[model samples]
Target chain A: MSNFDVIAMALKNLFKRKLRTFLTILGVIIGTASIVVMISLGLALNKNFDSQISQISDITLIHVVGVDQISSQSQGSKNKIKMDDSAVYNFKQIENVESVSPIINLSYAIKAISGKYSATLNLVGIDAQFLETLGYELESGRFLNDDDKLNIVCGGQVPYSFAKNTKRRFYFYDPNQQEKAPDIDVMKDRITISVDMDYGNIDTTGEKSTTSTAKAHPVKFVGVLKYDDFSYSPSDYNCYMTIEQVKKLKAEKQKFDKSSANNNSGFYSDNNSDGYNEIDIKCKDINSVKDIAEKVKDMGYNAYYAGEYLESMRSTAANMQALLGAIGAVSLFVAAIGIANTMVMSVYERTREIGIMKVIGASIYDIKKLFLVESSTIGFLGGIIGALFSLLISYLLNTTNISFFNNDSYIYMSSAAQKPLVSLVPLWLCIAAVVFSGLVGLLSGYFPARRATKLSALTAIKSE
Target chain B: MKNIIELSAIKKIYKMGSEKIVALNNINLNFEQNKIYCILGTSGSGKSTLLNLIAGLEKPSAGQILFKNMHIENFNEEQLAEFRKKYIGFVFQSYNLFPTMTALENVSLPLVFSRVPKKIRIKRAREMLKNVGLENRINHKPSQMSGGQQQRVSIARAFVNNPQVIFADEPTGNLDTKTTFEMMDLITGIARKNNQTLIIVTHDLEISDYADTIIHIRDGVVDEIKNKE
Candidate 1:
């Protein structure tokens, strides 16, 4: 008989016992839904970990620090790998390296001031041309260009960087606007930058006394970055300037008066030439972080990235998925048994019909295909319904009222762009669930279909 | 007329716990094309067993049943099924139709196994049902039909495929006397019109009166052969 005829007959047979077929399909639905939902929870956990890691550090960035900074670990290693212009150039030559910029962090020796307001400064000096590639987002103004001389990009916290205004605080998502707004507008105002630590001392300035003076230069305002609770970009809470401008500021400080500038800036430890103290390397993608970091470590510089944490977190999620999936498979196993039992009962009930078909020239292959098609159709229906049901359940569980996965790491994704997830059913998981249930049906129906094919036409005809 | 089926020295034995009961022994027969043959025997006289053997439903222990120069007894189950599909049709004593299928579906079943397209097979089955005077009961299932009407549906099914050979094992076994005569006439008439071989196994002498040849069997062996034409 033709396959089309066999399928038509199989569907008719399934339709003959609607209640039994429905019950069998219900078992498979529960099985598939349980598996899909379980894996979705594990996927949510993976997403949560990724969100948390992204808050503290970019997974693709490798921070290269000079050996002098790692004095605790490498006491005598003469490895001359400095975090300088040469090291930055060599890192850019590495495969998969997207961009490299040398950086220097100065927290104490730098100060910025408006007419009557003094601001405490954490200044970061880097290549001005690489500002855009470094993932800095602007709140008001533009990034520093290559032609900028004394321009500086202020941090997102520039409003609260007052020197002694200890009572004032800044909240990123402040709702009650009753708190006194800062009088300083960094983006529109010009600021004077001084390399002297004692530039703003009132007592020494009141008497014009013996503190060696360095003139503060007027720096132009460029960009002010927007705050991102989930990002660790370099310009988040610091001012960015070109490395050449900061170096020139230091030179001017020394030329004006050698005493205060030569005092204790900690910009150097006397064991090295003039080079940058830090280099930030941006990789093309997350997968290249570990390899590039390892190569930098071989060059005797300290390389740090969050790729190791990402690996452990991902493996943990995968293990959870396996455990949960196996637990759900037990129910599916029971459903398979239900399918087998239903098919076996159908075989016995239709023994006489099978005999009629055989004597009427229907082949044994046709008989087998008929039963198999019936069971698989049940599975296909159950699988599709079950996968969709899993999505609904996941959404309900992840809702704010349930808050099933409300945890520390998930707080950032609750923003408008994305929601915090407790359960996540991806597309491929649904496809896998459907295909797996069909295979289960095919397997369960195998023996019963075999028994149907082995039925003797004469005896079966005589049976009833 | 030419012999379409030849059976020689056929033997069928049943084993019941080390006891061998011989159902048929030394049976030799030839069925000619375009002729009706009747094998008459009392109950338990191996008439039905002979019909089953010649129909390729049962294999004999020692025999050569030849059809178109091929040994039917030596053919495997699959080959026998293929051979049956190509050349054989059956009208059972109980009118074994699928209880769920309608009269038209029952008649078209043979054509379905022959892989005839749906449109052509339905058309052929409808025509065959019309010939058996079941044109109005085409949609009625076997359970909804009377014994005579069900038997007519079975006859239509047998002739729908137009096979080379038709076997009827007590075709009217459950019918009244008038219905039995009518079923026999309808089946024999279709077989003769198609120039096909018809073999009927029954004990009723009245039913054998419609046959072209009659063979009487006693015990496992043939007692006499008589040609009425």
Candidate 2:
């Protein structure tokens, strides 16, 4: 018979027993929905984890620390590696390296005085041009520019350090009173940075001594940083200045220290003769971070990047998805068994009908095709309904904040500023669900269809 | 007249546990084209078994059964299905109409198996039903019609494919006397009009009167052969 005729007949037979067909198809629908929802939830978790990690630090940025002592394989001897301007230039030449900045840490004892309020703060020097590429988002004013060498930007919480006078101490561990913005505006007020030669000194009696002499340097506040919940780096509590400006301040401090009776050696002297203590390198893409980091380590420097953590996070997400998929697969396997059972029952009930068909010149292939078409139609119909149901569940999960589990148990809990979209169903997944269910139906009907074809016309016709 | 089917030394055996029962024993017969023939026999006389062997529904154990000189016993199941589709039609005592299908659909089944297009097959089925006086009942299902009408629909189905031969096994066995005579007249008239070979198996002697040739079977073998013309 024509394929169209066979399909029509199969449909007619299925419709003959509507309730049974519907029940079988319902099993498939539940199977498909379970799988799709499970996979979609896994994808949503992965996306949330990625966004949280991205907010903390740039995955492509690698921190390079100079090795104090390294074993030189070529010379068969030990040597020291310095992270200097030359190292920055070498890193810039590395493939996929976008930008490199040498970090010069200044240990000058300095305090910022605005009107009567003053505070002691840490300081770090960085390249003014590469500040934007380093992913530092400014809060108020523009970032450091090459032309503004003397300008400085205060951290978001730096303003909270100023009190009524210089003797007023600030404690970071105090949690009773939240720090408020100081009355003195660093952006508008005339701020002077004073360096103390005898800062942190003690007498023979072990009593704290005030600075005997100090020099003040006038400076401009160009910008302030935005507060980051996850950032505990110096940028959160210290100040940033151009490398040239810090170099000049260091030279002045050295001159003043040499003229004093108390000739205390500087802490920055070890790498001061050649280069800075560290360098930060930015890669063009996250995928290239590992390769560039390895190259920097091969040059006898210590490299640390977030790529390793991100890699582990990705693998964990994939494993969770696979586990969820297996759970879904078990449901679909049960649905397939339902289909096979239904088809076998149909064949048993239609034995006489099948015999009549055989007597009327219907081929064994036609008999098999008819049963296969019936079962597959059930599968395809179930898949469509199941996909639609999954989409509805996904939409509800994304829009609603109904939390069934402990909030802290979720990986995306840190990024709780917005409600998490916990389920995501992509287009490819919908299509695959439909096609896979259909294949399951075909496989389930195989044995039943074969049995229908092998039925004896003589015995079957005689059967009631 | 040319022989449409020939059975030479054909045997059919059935095994019930360790006991052996011979259904047909060394039977030799020839059915001519464009002629009405009947195998008259009582129950368990092998008349139906002989008809089944001739239709390629069963295989012979010791001899050859040929349709137009082709050994039908050697044909595989698939080949037999093809043979039945192209050259044979069957009418059963139970009518065997698919209750879910309409009268027109029931009649058009053989044409469907032959791969005839829908429009043409429906048109031919309508014409054949009209010839059997079932034109008005084309849309009625088998359950909706009487036994006589159901048998008429079955007859229309048998002749709708325009096969070379038609087999009827107790076609009127479930009908009353008047309906039986009506069914016999309709079947024989159609077979004559189409010039097709007709083979009917019945236990009733009155039903054998309509056939041009009669082969009386007894004890798994042919007892006698009689011709009217």
Candidate 3:
């Protein structure tokens, strides 16, 4: 018989017993909906975790520290690895490495003065070309460029670090009253940089040494960086300048210090000539971070990347998804059994009808196909309804502040303040649910359809 | 007259526990084309078994049954179903109409299985129901119709496909005397009008009188064959 006739007959048979068909389909609906909702919940949790982690650090950025520093701190090794311009050039040659920035933390003691507001500043010098690639968000103005002369970029908390010059106390933690942010705008203000000449000086003889005067240089404030509560780098409350400008200032300071000393004993340390203190490497892709970090470590540098932590987090999320999926599978397996039972009962009830059909020229294949179509129709219908119901459940879970997912006691403390969507069902998942349910129905109906085909026409016709 | 179906040395056996019961014993028969034949027997005489074996609904233990020079006894289930679709039709004693369908739909079922288009099958079914005097009740289901009317619908179904041979197993067994005569007349008239072979199995001798030839079956064997014309 034609496929159309088989389907028509199957539909007629199903509609003949409406309540039984509905009940069977309901089993499949519950199965599909539970599976979809459970998996979607796992996906949503993983997404929220990733966003929270991204707020703290750049997952793709790798910090390259001196191997000697790490070995010395950890194992009391005297060996030192120098981080200089050549180190930056070598790191940039690594495969999958996108960009590299050489950083110098200056040892010179300096202070920023804006009217009466003065504060000791932690200064860092870096290549101006890598300012954009460092992943720092600017609050205002622009970062330092190669052409900039004596221009500085300050961190968002730099103004708050200022204090009264006399008492030398931080404005952020004044004991007598609540501290306020200094009235100093880094983007529009002219900041005076005072170089303390007395810094790094110690008298060997038992004589009273006079403190030298501070040399003040007026520098244009360029930009302010965004504040990060959990920054992996020491960018907060620091002033950033180009390496060339910082080198010039250090050279001039060294020359003046040599002139004041009777002997040329006040020279800066020889190790400071190489300029950079550390190197930062940006990878082309987050997945390539681990390989690049390993290559850097092979070169005897200490490499730190967030890819390891991100990988562990992803593995945990995947395990959670699998557990949820397995739980859902159990319900679907039960629904499959229900479908098989319903199909077997249908075959039993339609024995006489099957006999009549056979005697009236219906082939065994046609009879079997009819039963298979009937059962699969139940599955297909149930899957459609189940997917739609899952969408509804997802929306309700996302929109409603359910106690279990949204409570303060939940593990995602960072995302707890803002309501995170607890459930998400994507498009591919809906399609997969329908197709999977239909396949399950087909598998469940196989034995029953076979039994239908094996029925004896002579005996079946005689059945009352 | 040319023979349409020939049966020789046909035997059917049923095993109940360890005992073997011979349902048909060495039955030899030849049914001619365009003729009405009746097999008359009492209950337990194996007339229905003979009919079933001839229809290829049951396989004989030993036989050489041929239809149009092809071996019917050796045909598989699928081949038998194909053969039945092309050459045979049946009217059961219980008027086994699908209760869910109308008379017209019941008549069109064989054609539907034969993969005929819906419009042509329905058109032919309506014509055949009209011929069976069920024109007004074409849309009426079997449960909604009287016993005789349901039987008429069953006869309409058998004739709708216009097969080469028609088998009626106790066609008038459940009808009143007047309705029985009407049913027999309607069935014989259709067969004769179309020159189709007809076989009837009945226990009533009165029903056998309507056939052109009568075979009396006794104790699983043919006792006598009488030709009226």
Candidate 4:
């Protein structure tokens, strides 16, 4: 018999027992939806972690560092150790270590028109070679240059300088007097800044027991800090100047301390004994960062890259994906069982009908295929529904009030240009959902179909 | 006359609790083409067993059954399916029409199994419905029709495929006296018009009046074979 006849007949039979068919299909629906939703959650987590990864560093960029081992039996003896200069030289020799530099951290003041902002300064004293390693783009000014005197670079969105504008507006007057005019921007243009500085040693415990014998430098105002509100980033109030200028101030301070120490030249202990305290090493690609860091650690220093943070973020996303996938898969399994039960019941109810078909020349294979087609159709419908529902749920949660961390206070709202918590479902996942549900239907219906086909025609005919 | 169905020394033994009961004994019978033959017997008299053997629904323990010289007893399930599709049509006492299908759809079932074109099958089914005086009831399901009317639809289905043989198992058993005669006339007329062999298994001897030949079966044995002029 033609396959259509089998399918048509099976469909008719299914329609006859509408509630039973639906209950059976519901099982498959639950199973399919669970699988789809689980996988979808996996995708969502994958996207979230991937975005967080970019926050640490551009995945394409790598970092390199220098180090030295303190002992022969140190933990990382497998790799060679080298000094900062030697490390820089070796990195330069490597074909893929694009650039390298030695850096030092020193404290400095960020001067503004109204006040001075003195925070713990991360004074990254880098040469022109190590500029790319910082991963910061300059918004309006140039980066550090070898020949350009007194020039410095900073992150593109850093708030180092502030600007103000003034405008005029009309003010209301008393009933007995003429209309008055005032410049509203004048009051707002006068910026005020309160500077909190931590000098030599202040006892935070005792109220008035702080002492400072050393002289404090009073900074002058050159510019105000600009506004930068990058999401999740702790703001840095910074000032930019040449590395030479900062070193000169340190040298003068060391000399003044020595002169005041009863003319003892060695008393200051040669403050700049270690010429380079920090370094930002840049490389050709991200894949090399972990290896380079290991090499640097062997040299007796802590080494890391922007890309390491990205790796952590990616791992976080992968874990979340697995969690969601598990949840979805459970439902799909339950649905398959439902489909199996429905087909079995159908076989029992249609025993006589099956016999009639057999007598009218329907083959055993024909009967089997008929039930299989009905089951496949149920799975197909469930898949389509589950896919659409998953997509809708993802969009709703991402756009509305749903938090994975259960922290309503820490909701990350999407601003005008930024995308909302990404609900990304791949095309392959949709296809998988459909095919998987269909296969579940097929498997669940197989045994029942066989049993129905094996029904002896004589007995089936005699059955009421 | 050519023998459309020939059964030689057929035996069907059944085990009932402790005793072995013979549903059909070693009996030989030949059913000719273009003739209506009836096997008349009471309940449990082996008439249905004889029909089943001829339809290839059951196999005899001894001897063989041949349809147009092809031994059906030797054919496998798949082969029997093919045989039924091309050459056999069956009508049951309870009017075994698929309740889900309309009368016309039930009649076209045999044609569908044979992979007949949709247009041609529907047309042939409609013509068969007309032949059985069920033209207006073509779209009604078996549940919507009376017992006699349902049997008529079943007869149309049996004749729709133009099979070599039509087997009716108590076709008029569920019908009233007036409806039984009407149904018998319709079935016999269609079988005669198609020049096909008709085998009717019935307990009602009155309904055998329409048949050209009658075979009396008693206690699994053939008692007599009578031919009317």
Candidate 5:
């Protein structure tokens, strides 16, 4: 028979028992929707984890805290590789290494003083040229130039860190974003950084030591930084200075503290020429982070980045997805049995009709094809509607606060992040669901259709 | 006239557990082209088995059946379907119309199997229905028609493909005398009009009156062969 004839007859037969057909199709619809939504949930979890990780740490940036001297291949070979100038040179030679910048803080001894207002913060000293690669967003003015001697770029929340007399701590409270305008007009005021912790302290005892207070240099407030939320931003409460500027301040402070023999306040007489304790290295991409970080570890350094954590998180999400997909597969399997049952019953009811057609000249192939087409049509319809239905379910899931699991477990570092979307559907998954359901229909109908083709024409026609 | 179908030394045996019941034995028959023929016998006389054997519904134990010199018994299931699609038609005792299909759709079934295009098949089915006096019942389903009308639709279905032979098995068994006479007249008139071979299996002597040749069988064997032409 012609294709049109077969298809038309199939559709007619299905409509003959509309309620049964609808129930079978409903089973398939539920099956397909469950599968798609379950997979989408797993995918969205991974996406959420990625965004959370990106907030706390740059996946492409690796921080080398210390050299692993004991674990090094050449343990006692030559000079030790530390997180210093020599290590920076060695790190640059590694392929895919974009840039390297050392991070140094003058031991919280530096205080920013603007008349009566002063703030004690971690006064970091970085190479002025490396500021561009450091991903700092300035709210006003410009970045420190290469020739800048004392130009300082204050952090986004530096103003809130300032207290009136440097005695009482200023604990600012902004739950989501702990950043706001400075209490003092830092941009316009004449500020100086002093190594003496008592630079702006109210001397309650009125006791004058033999040595005068350490010299405080005048500082230009070059710029203020934008308050991008601290959940992902790095060092939003610290201020920056050129490396030379911090060295000059700290060396002078060491000389004064050493001369005062009575003041053995744990100040180091050595110039720390060994190297800075921490170095930040940026890579070209997240994919290269693990490889270069591994090479640095082999060279005896504790190189760390988010890629390792991300890989583990991705695998966990994949495992969870497979589990969820298996759950959904059970639904489809049940629906397949429903289709098979319906088709078998249809074959039984149509035995006499099949015989009549055989006598009228229908081939066995035609008989089998007719039944398969009917069942597959049910499956295809169910799958298509199910895909669409899952989208609706996904929208409801994301919009409504349906927390399948707390993101606190999935987030890499930050605990204060907003909840991640719970469901995500890719285009291919929807298409696969439909095609797979149709294939399931064909497979389920196979036996019933075979039985139909095997019905004896003489006996079948003789039946009432 | 040339013979269209030939059956020689045909035998049909039905197995009842360990017992073998010989339904038809040592039967020989020939049907001519474009002639009305009948196989007449009483109930359980093996006439139906003989008809079934000739129709290729059941294989013979030791015989050869040929149609137009092509051995019908040798053809496999697929080739038999091909043969039937091109040459054979069937009308049943109960009409056997597809309950859901309209009268026109039922009539066009054979043509649909023959791979005739829809428009042309519908046209041929309409013409055949018109010949059977069912032109007004084109869209009526079998449940909506009387037994006579349903039989008329069945006759149209059998003849729609313009097949060379039509088989009517107890076509009047379910009809009243008036309706049965009308159905026979309509069926035979169309068969003769197309110059096609007709094979009717029935026990009624009156129903066999229209046939050009009648074969009488009793107790699994042909007892008489009469030619009225």
Candidate 6:
């Protein structure tokens, strides 16, 4: 028989039994919704995680550290050791090595004196080139220029604390955004101090030593940094300075030590000509930072990053998303069961109708198609409803201030000022949810259609 | 006149718990075109069984049943459906009208299955409904109509296909005497007007008057044939 005839009859039959038909369709709707929602949730989680990971550090970054000479000696000479400046230079030559910077720890307190305000703040010195080696967005003023002499910049908290004691305001436009005014200014206004020695004991004896106040230079308040809640604190913080200033301080301390006949505070080298205690080497690009770090480690010094401090902070969100997706998929499986049940009932209720169609010259193919169409339609409707529901949920979650980010467990390096948290659904993900739900309907409907076609006409017609 | 339905030594056997009971015993029968015939029997006498066998709804246990020289007994289920659609019309005792459909739609079903155009199918179905005097009740579903009206709609469905043979299995069985005669007259009148072979299986002796020939069956065997001059 013609396809229209069977479809018309089946539809009419279904309409006659409205409750049964609706119930069957409901099963498919639930199934489709479950599948779509499950997958959508999973995808949303994955997306959140990926963005979080990218925020902390690009996945392609490779960390390189200097092979510890002290450890190598203790472990015996079996391990080859060739880590040196040449290795750092070689890493820079690598194809994908975008940028590299060497990190060193030196804690020193700074004593600043303006007309009325004066305070001591501990600071780690990072070179101007080191800023370029990492993904750092300047808030207000420009980044440290190559020609900057004795220039200084500080993290988000530093300016907040420093400006409290000083008359000059720190202003820097947040580089993470656009159209906002400059808020941080670290140029010619904030003063930073350096000690003659790196955490060395100050001599109590001798000519009016460190106990006596020394002259403090006025540093510019060029810019302010946007808060990264995942990283560094403002109270005791790192500061950017020219390598020449650190060398000058070391030389002055050595001269004072020699004159006093005391060897206690004269710990480090005297000049930039004698090589720096820390060197912040930068590569041409950020992509090669990890490779260059590896090379730097091979040279015998520790390579560090501001990015590594925020690693867990970024990755935790991604992990949460993955977990969410996995949880959502379980609901879809239940939906599939609903669809199956509906289809089975439909087959049962329409046995006589199917038999009649067969008697009226309906082909087996036609019978199979009719059932499949009905099932597919049910699934498709379910998917649409599910998608709408999911969209609403997503919208609510986004609009609500439900904080899924920023916690005490997040490892905040000395760099972060505020926690990072946001959720966004991509277009492709929405489309995929729709298409996947449709596919679920088709697959779930297939078995019932086959079963309906295989039913014997004699028996089906005889069914009461 | 050519015989439209022919049965040669057709046997129908029923197996009841390993015991084979012969329902129709080597019955050989021929039905001529343009005539009304009734198979008269009590329940389980195999008269309805013979009708089913002739309609290709059931296959014989032995021997061949032929329709216009084609061996219908040898036809498979699907082939039999095609054969029925093309040449045979059925009128069941309970007037098996699709309950959801109106009288016109019910009558149009066979033609619809025939792949006839919608306009043509509807027109022919309306005409057939008119012939059965159900033109006014064309839009009424089976459940909304009386037994006589439903039976008339059934007769229209059978005739709408313009089949060569019409098989009625106790068309008046479920109707009252008044409606029974009305149904029989409408069915026989339509079949005769179309010059089609009408086969009726019934227990009512009064209904036999509408037939030109009657085969009285007893105990799954044909006892006698009566011609009403």
What fnat does each of the candidate structures reach? 0.40, 0.62, 0.72, 0.70, 0.68, 0.32
What is the C-alpha lDDT profile of model 4 across A1-464, one tens digit per residue?
Answer: 68777778767777888888777777666666667666666566566555545644455443443343454247556764543567567656655566766654443321122222112232345565345345544444455556544344443222322321111111121223213222212112332211112232124553422242234443322222222333332113233434565455445545454454323222124333446554556666767767766665654665676567656756766776777777777778778778877888888888998899899888787888998998887877777777777677767767875556322322342223444364666788878888888888888889888899889888888898
* DockQ ranking from best candidate downward: 4, 5, 3, 2, 1, 6
The CAPRI quality class of candidate 3 comes to medium
| Model 2 residue A49 distance off true place after TM-score fit, in angstroms | 3.8
lDDT of 4 by residue, B122-201 (tens): 99999999988999999999999988889989888888889889999988878888998888888888888889888899
Error of 2 at A172 (Å): 9.9
Q: Across residues A1-464, which tens digit of lDDT does each residue of candidate 6 receive?
A: 46676567656655666785676556545554444444454454445444455555545445454456675576567754443345446656666655544333233334443323333343334455656455566655755665666565555555434322332322232435333422333454445443422221223442323443334455664544455644433322456555455445545544555664434332233233233344444545555566666655655556565344444534654575566665555655566566667778878977987777665555566677777666555556666666666566656655665545434433233124332333444566556666666676677778988898788765676687
The docking category that best describes candidate 1 is acceptable
Candidate 1 regions exceeding 4 Å error are A36-60, A65-132, A142-151, A160-183, A190-220, A226-234, A241-278, A283-288, A299-302, A327-333, A387-407, A413-417, A421-440, B203-206, B216-219, B223-229
Provide DockQ values for all models, in the order shown. Answer: 0.48, 0.64, 0.69, 0.74, 0.73, 0.45
Can you write out model 5's per-residue Cα lDDT over A225-287, one digit (the tens) per residue?
776653546557667888777777767767666675535322333344557747888999878
Candidate 5 has a DockQ of 0.73
Residue B83 lDDT (model 5): 81
Q: Can you write out model 3's per-residue Cα lDDT over A126-232, one digit (the tens) per residue?
A: 78877778789888888889998788887777766765444352335332321445566666666777555333233456332345544678888888888654332
Candidate 3 structure quality by residue, lDDT tens digits, B1-229: 9999999999999999999999989999999999999999999999999999989999999988889888999898889889998999999999988999999899999999899999999999999999999899988999999999999999998988899999999998999999999999999999999999999999998988889999999989999999997
Candidate 5: residue A102 lDDT (0-100): 81
Candidate 4 yields a Cα-based lDDT of: 0.68
Better structure of 2 and 6 per DockQ: 2
- After superposition, candidate 4 runs with Cα above 4 Å error: A60-83, A107-121, A133-135, A160-277, A294-301, A306-316, A405-422, B16-19
Error of 6 at A122 (Å): 7.2
Indicate the residue-level lDDT of A313 in model 5.
86
- TM-score of model 1 relative to the true fold? 0.80
Could you say which candidate leads in DockQ? 4
Error of 3 at B90 (Å): 1.1
Candidate 5 CAPRI assessment class: medium
Ranking of models by lDDT: 5, 2, 3, 1, 4, 6
Clashes of 1: 0
lDDT of 2 at A171: 27
* DockQ result, candidate 4: 0.74
